[model samples]
Target: MPKSYLITGGAGFIGLTFTKMMLKETDAQITVLDNLTYASRPLEIEALKKNGRFRFIKGDIYEKEDIEKVFYQK
Candidate 1:
């Protein structure tokens, strides 16, 4: 089975770098949760939208409902 990843802060530099590394090295399904905070650059992540294994959510980790929505997503 393919691995599934929930990456917080994924629109930030290091996070985006690690996400790219994962994509290059493994067949993993990735979900990114970011609020487009000051440190985040949505444009960088936007390029990843073309990958079927990747998904992005515009949400804050501090929000309970947002976290629950990602967790329960089918």
Candidate 2:
């Protein structure tokens, strides 16, 4: 079975690059959790949105409910 990874700050430069690399290197699914508040680009995230294994959540760390939803529901 393929593994799953949660990437915080995944919309930033380094994070986006790493996310791309991870997708290319593995068959595992990737969940990008970003608030989309600062230092993030919607276009970049959009590019990966079409991939079945890629998911993006526009939420902040301060939001416990949002964070919990992903972790617990998964």
Candidate 3:
């Protein structure tokens, strides 16, 4: 099976930095779920998207539907 990771609040500084580290160190598919309330780093996100293994999802973790959307990928 392929490796995958779901990172919450990844648009923020610490999370985004960690995401980049993961991208460099691991071959896992990294997905980020961030509400973008605290911070909105569109440029960084866009840069990360250039990588095929990186994905960004904008949604609140408190919402059940939003959480479901992450695992219910088609």
Q: Candidate 3 local accuracy as lDDT?
A: 0.91
For model 2, where is the 10-residue window of minimal lDDT? 65-74
User: Using alpha carbons, what is the TM-score of model 3?
Assistant: 0.90
| lDDT for model 2 | 0.89
lDDT of 1 by residue, 9-34 (tens): 89999999999998889999999999
**Full candidate order by lDDT, most accurate first:** 3, 1, 2
TM-score, cand. 1: 0.92
C-alpha lDDT of all candidate models, in order: 0.90, 0.89, 0.91
Please give the ranking of all candidate structures by TM-score, highest first, separated by commas.
1, 3, 2
lDDT of 2 by residue, 1-74 (tens): 99999999899998999999999999999999998867898899999998999988877777998798668765
**TM-scores of all candidate predictions against the true structure:** 0.92, 0.90, 0.90
The Cα error of candidate 1 at residue 4, in Å, is 0.2
**What's the lDDT of the predicted structure labeled candidate 1?**
0.90
- State the lDDT of candidate 3 residue by residue for 7-46, as single tens digits: 9999999899999999999999999999887476878998
Model 2 residue runs over 4 Å out of place are: 72-74
Model 1 bad stretches (over 4 Å)? none
